[model samples]
Target: MKKLYIFVLVLLSWNLQGQGLPGLGAGTTPNNKPILHGKSWVAITGKPLGASAGATIFNQGGNAVDAACAMIAATSTMWDVLSWGGETQALIYNPHTKKVIAINALGYAPTGATVDFYKSQGMDYPPQYGPLAATTPGTPGGIMTMLAEYGTMSLEQILKPSMDLAKGYPLEAQTANAMEAQKARIKQWPYSKKIFLPHLGEEREAPEVGEIFVQEDLYETLSKLVEAEKNALAEGKSRKEAIYAAYDRFYKGDIAKEIVRGTREQGGLFTESDLANWKVKIEEPLHVNYKGIDVYKLQEWTQGPALLQSLNILENFDLKSMGYNSANYIHTLYQAMSLAFADRDFYYGDPAFVDSPMEGLLSKEYAKERAKLIKEINDPKIGPGDPYPFQGGTNPYSDILNQNKEALASLPADQLNSSLDPAFIEAFQSGTTSVETADAEGWVVSVTPSGGWIPAVVAGNTGVGLSQRMQSFVLDENLNPYNLPEPGKRPRVTLTPSLALKDGKPMLAFAVQGGDSQDQNLLQLFLNMVEFGMDVQEATEAANINSYQMQSSFGNHEVRPGAIVLRKDTPAWVNKELVDRGYQIELWNKTSGPLNAIWFDWKHGSFWGGSSDYGDDYGIAW
Candidate 1:
């Protein structure tokens, strides 16, 4: 009963905090509007309650890493967090150390996952869903890693709100809508059905708004992890040591053994050693300069550098003179994106495996040469450009991809044919939620945790949903050296969380989820902030264009070829001009991105933030 009282008080406080930002107070509006919170500290998440979760951590004097992890933990409980079986990739900026670190909290294929293994089973490729699509979960260890490296808080403290939330929490509109819509899919997996579709009557309907959604199983799973940490602490482990102990329990102990046991019992490819030896990569960030600002993103394992390559090419043109959202500006955006993707197709592979032409790809000379390919007329036949005299060679992956061409031809490929509209692609690329946070002292963290949603399955009731990221790995060999299904190779991914620095200090930190569109989304938002002189809120609300001219990062990997998706409200002249340029344009009522950003104006000593929606309580603060 006391717990119920505390929860009620928290709800009341959430209502009160809703008044934090003017004009966005405690409303039942489905869409959160964009707003500016110019305080010394701020946070932004997909849901208002999520931001509140971070606020609690910040109030406890937690740094950006702690607060961001806290909010994500809360997110993992409520909606698509664990259910999506996705990995959490993050970029953390420490003002004290004056260094930015990249956390490649990604999954790798099990050792037994060989392309030939699938070929022998009458399957040319790994299944896009089910046990075959899974990898050892990285979220559990990823959060622990951050807490050990940068956070002052412990796992037990950070996960408290999330644990409470798992017991029960009110449903938001998007989450409730997803729950109802995913019923049929979730029902196919008994464990998923048990968590999401526990009905009291013969007729099971989607839970209504404000309904209390509960997940005792997930809570128990998390509790066990926390208990493991506590046991270590009780045994005289330091805070960091306790975190490591918990990591061992999750990855090398009972949990790992259970997952392996389940996999063998189910005839899956995973083994106990697969979990025991797995490790997340702590890589140095790839740095690029757009004008004077230094932008950082994960290396080739993610499609992060695509932004650098595209922006480099776009810099050759007079974008400002073309006008924002105008047909000329939109055309240039599409053309530059096409040329950059051509380079990305052949060169942007795992640097460790492939001789990634990184040095040449980011060179201004390469951008200048690639810039020459941007034409007023659309050309679907466009392919890769030379990064240098020695590099940018033949399409290595094409020969193998061609061999399996017939295999992909027989699969459920290119759902974009349904509408080729923004709605379809938006649902594809931007289906995941994003979170960002910053402390008063200049620490910042930006994260995008996506994967696991389309066809979610529990790892044998371990409460860790496996990410379907195997969909990103190719069965064809030598096609993309970086993403081959080797035992320890990281799959080249579409998740890109970015950080911007000016004068060797943190300036802007943001991230968005839109698959390959993440590059377009981040580029637009960055340009919106730097070029247009828009504040974070204005930049977030600014209408942007999306180009689908490149091969998809997932699915059957069909190229969109001269395709551009625009907002429905774009000036008719923009559409007309694009049509005249031999382009395919499909406009929709919504944009393909939901951006969350926080800006640090070091000179003025102020922090500002905004999201896709505006509510008085919208942006994060206590």
Candidate 2:
């Protein structure tokens, strides 16, 4: 009541003019540093405008889910890579019900995307970019669903910020950098080049850091959806029905048809059925008790469970006693994550298609048995451990695991070409957005929205986007236990979001955007906060480390066994020690990008917003 009391006074003094009461709290922080904190409903989002949009929503009587929808709307429009026509996943915690709901909006393969289709094309795998790589988008439906089920605001209100952003907005430094880095992909599509490569100072180039970038088509696209909702309202439909009307405009109406026409005309194998049949699945969230704190993650379809599995193994050790970021700590994280990710490479996929052995995979007893396999020295390769065998059941993935091992055994490490080069990593580094929100009433949401970008051909004249995530599917069914290309099956993605609860109360929500780095960076940031006693802001500002030891989820599925990267600021001795231990170590430049999270102090009835100092990450707490 005390913190809430102070928050009321702050909000009471606040207005809609973008002004703040300074003495009451440090409501915001500058870029390239820590972050701001306060005792109120807070928004930590990918960009400043997104955060501001959330703050406005919160002040206007919206709940956390409403604010989350508003922030994502702004994020999708501002960053082309973290697009409107993309994939998304979210974990929402309901305090009253003590239930955490998982929203999986990641797109699925079109009916035409199948092993036989790839075989007929003489393609070993789905191409990494363009129309050939598209999947049925899920973001539009996901956002609308969130608004319909959980949000308080209407589609028109939440979408207003995005409409403004798409029609015209100043290009931030982060987007400018993305435009420059993904220049080649942008050039491949006239629609993208026209939007992103606007002429600056008499030269056609990536927009200068603060120049304006406009997407007239995108503005029209979003407006059309809103028009549908408004028309439904005018016809005396319920608010929820109006939201559904808006969703239909994108999923089954003219927009969806236009998207199908555009992609198929550009050689994409898609039909209206793919878009109409698309639906976001809501399921129970996966949870694990980590050192008495409950942690929630997406299911096995994502690389999410790896974080929990790693926690289970690491729980056996005294991490604080080992000293933070020590050689022992780093080695242990590497080994544990390696083992979990081996399982990820072999077992993680659309659960509808594969038996993931979820019961054993999440059991503490299984983690104990698997921990015995971690050696004192690092192992370049590990097992897709037989979770079912450990749990005294039949292992469904056994045959596929054995086949994958045999395939790798036949290919020498030196001859294996990886797709995780400078260019590929740079493309990922350019994209994605995350939002974390917590309201005074205790509703919380952590969402990681990603995929659609410049590389994919635009969706016809609709001024919309489609995902290139079909490449995440597998070519050889034997090598991919759960990720074989199948109609209506979601791809095994790296888009994992994390939620933390203290003593049965929701405490923290977080997500990141570096493809495979999503889990690694998030795992590190979580440990930084919970294990090393760092605040949310310092946890993000802290230097990061990552590994590419597992076969990538993206194109080519290359394995960079035992490869590890650390930021230069990490102690030189730690790098030398890891190298001495036979792990391939590369120094990362500026580590990871724009990781966002929010922590709620239930005891104080306060909320704290945090973000990485990198990119355009910003926080608003008032």
Candidate 3:
């Protein structure tokens, strides 16, 4: 009853509040009493309630790292897109220390996972079974790591808000819609259905905005962690043990058994040993110098290298002179992306398994070699480039041959006739709910947590389909494996979280949530803020575009026609230039991505942040 009362009060408060920004979905509300007086934070998630979860942490005196963890936990409950059981990567900036740290919270393949092992089982590759496909979730590991290194608040204190919210809260329309969309699968998992389907035996419409939504099992799970933490503290258990215990409950205890059993029964490959041996790897971040700014990016294991390459190519062009979002500007950006992506397909991979010279690849000299390919004024239909020989020679046809082989191999032998069709190539361009925040104490964080292409609907996991991440692999033209299967290799991913600094201080903290569009959106937003001198709000409001017309570093080799997509709100002059550039223009009804950003204006001595009002729910606080 008390819980119901508190929920009602929150609902009332929500109704009375004014909406925050334009692109930030429906539930955002601005708080005048900023959490950081001279500092600001922007958090973007798949749902509004999720952003609020993190904002609450900021209000409770937690720093940006804490806020990021809180937001991730909250979003796991509400969005179900990515959860604690998924991969996580982050870039944290500590202004006081004047240092930036990268956290690779990506899960490793199980010890039992080997290329030969799959062949022995008569399966060509490891299947995407929920259990088999599940990597040890890195979100929890990453969060704990950050908390231990930088956060001031205790784990229990930091997690309280998420725990409370998980006990029960009013379901929103978006969440309810997702539930309905995956109803059949939810009904399969009795435990999941128990939490998601409260109506049970009775027929009823899905729970609405104000109705209570509870996940008792999840609550119990979290409660056990809290209790274990307390008990460990009392029993003199080391901090590592307490953390391990909390993680054990999910991966090695009852939950682990359930996951293992489910996978085994489904003929999956995840073994108990796999769970026991999993550990997160910490590696150096990929950094590049762009226009006098030292830009830091994640390594090749993710799509970070692509952004580095794109920036390098962009630096070759006079982008500002071309004008922001103008046809010339967009064309140059697309061309740069194309050249960079071409290199990405052939070279980017796990450094441990593949001899990918990521450092050399991102070097200024390499950028210079790649930049020479871009024309200053002419925009041809940009194509991919060949990988530079490790021995330092050019092999112009190497990438083309490799890409053709990959395309042919991916198709079934019987369907090989249509395998190399250009139409099919263009279909691949389709592809993060990200979070960013900075506290007054100078702790800044950017996180991109994602699970792509839902696999088979897991029975009883509340229509919560697992990620078919295995599809991210790349193959050769004759269908031979180019990026050979290897255990513990981080698949080339599109999710990259970024931070920008000026004058040795955290100037702009930004991230974009869109697969291939991430770097494109980030580039646009950066230019909007730095070149055009737009404020956070205006920068966010500015319309931007992306393309499948370009090739990428990963296996997405489709080159789309000259089609440029723009927000309906873009000015007529911008549209005219796009048409003049021979682009078939398409207007996106809702902005395509949720780009959340916060900037520190040294000149004004103030902090400003804004969230996109796109199809995402985002918020900002200072």
Candidate 4:
């Protein structure tokens, strides 16, 4: 009996140890990380390294806007996969004004770029193809604009941390992994290779955790910008000239010329004139009403409108009554997503070029018509409906056909016998990285920066990357303008940052990294919070399901896999329901993209924050 008691005691002790704390000492989950003080606003991002940069700014008496500026600079250096000399968009919710102001830091295609240029080169546009595809980088300008207008600190103060970190910092595992993945591409650009490579020529082992990684040129660039900021303030230099000088030095001066020469030699279209003519435009964000609340999106130039359209379709359904993640709930969400994507593919584009009837599309009458079509397609296999008619012409079916053909042609020729040929890349395109913050005063900001498929990485310069963003044109067979490209015209973008307001107050500031998944993830995050009433952590960590079985925004006919991907922690019952709803449910051990979010609880006057648990190491602070 004594021996039995000892055995039982040991078993009990083991169980107690197992249950002591969920993520304690695990170092893998945010749940284990310490929470910050309640009143202080917390910023979350994909990397803790990047989050630390923002947190430092906040700790140093910076306001939410200042913190955002710091975060953007840090991300450009650390999270280069989704950041860097890319485009950016921001939505600021000002409690004082009780209004949301938007900054369209999105880069525009240069006036000189045209489809004919690519055709003349006898080369097809590769998705990841460089410098010729880049638009003017808008991130730096956007940061400066936001800081000068809404922030409390000077550019020098906001950028100091980023500059220091760039000079030398230990590479985290995530950054190292990304560097290795793009090692080949990094090698192609001398400046990139110098910073990312070990010994400057040969591929070296990734820096161990805590080992310092340095980018002296990037540091110099940040320093130059800071110096220019000071000069602008002290030397009577115009803000425009200072901003132009900073960007010009990075792009057109030495770095940009190298990139232009290299790309032109390789049959790319980037020109000196394109660089000189490039500018970031500030435009009005698209707004729609949902549940009597005003929701703003980044206008027709990006996929932001899809979020509104999805919400409109969802408004027709009783999501709250359906039970969160239930078969009915998931089905309704998927249906709404399908309808919105249909419109996104057919209509959404650079509004300056495409006559996207913003009002007609968001109108209840149009939404009802679209919703009825969604109901008609119960099979889930049926794709999007015809686009709404314009003044004289019907829906643009030919464009859809062309996009579909291009997607099909992109398929690997070796996969002729394969049953599953990806009509388009399942992964998101036009990568966007985001930052979110809400202060005690109720000022909330969500900013997303993105520019991809722009062959902008100038050779020999770590400071500048030229964008090749002019390829999004609708043209005739003769390579003439079906839609003529124009200056200051915002191109089709995927980066969109959003804010959730409840009763005229900021509830949460959220954004995701995937190109198309940005809106889908945002929608799911909203449902997880509002309908399911899950805490911020659970909602972000919850399993998500998306369909490739339909047409994507770029007009790729995705074979709807009807698959549902859930975080490993998802409840078994939720899985059963998803399967019952005809979803090919797959449980992912870990997903890649990070969803950054912060929640403001008015009832408790406390703030709760959470970031992606998939792999990113992020935390909150007082």
Model 4 residue 15 CA deviation (Å) reads 19
Per-residue lDDT of candidate 3, residues 1-622 (tens digit) = 9999988866665543321112222224443222223444545455677778777787787778888887877776554356545667888887676888888877655546556665676654444334555454566667666776677666787677668777788877756765665557556544445655666665553455668877665566567667766777788877656665666665566656655555555545556665555665655677776766666777777766777788877777777676666667777776677677655655666666666656556766777777787664323333344445423766534655566646644645343121223344323332347777777667778888765222233322322224434435443322222344556655566678887776688777777766666777777777766665555655665567765554332233344455556777666886776667656666776543667777776776666766766655567565
Tell me the TM-score of model 4: 0.81
How do these models rank on lDDT, best leading? 2, 1, 4, 3
Candidate 4 stretches greater than 4 Å from native: 1-37, 121-126, 200-209, 236-268, 375-426, 429-431, 452-456, 466-489, 550-564, 567-583, 590-593
Tally clashing residue pairs in candidate 4: 19
Q: How many residue pairs clash in each candidate?
A: 18, 0, 26, 19
**Taking the tens digit of each residue's C-alpha lDDT, what string does model 2 give over 1-622?**
9999987866654421111112233334332564556665878887788888888888888889988888888887876366777888999998788889999998888877888898798888887788778888788888899989988889898888888878778887767876777777867776666666776344547888767778898898899989999999999998899999989889888898888888888788779998898888998878899888899999987889999888888888788767667788889888888888887777778887777787888888889888888887777657677788666798765677777677767766565442346755653343567888888777899998877765546778766667878877888866565788888888888888889998778878998877777888888888877877666776776677777777777767767776777777667788888888878777766675578888776667787667886666778887
Model 2: how large is the Cα RMSD against the reference?
A: 7.4
**Candidate 1 has what TM-score?**
0.87
lDDT of 4 by residue, 266-308 (tens): 4455566656666556566676677765667778777788888
Model 4 scores what on Cα lDDT? 0.63
**Worst-scoring 10-residue span by lDDT in model 2:** 15-24
Best by lDDT: 2
Better of 1 and 2 by lDDT: 2
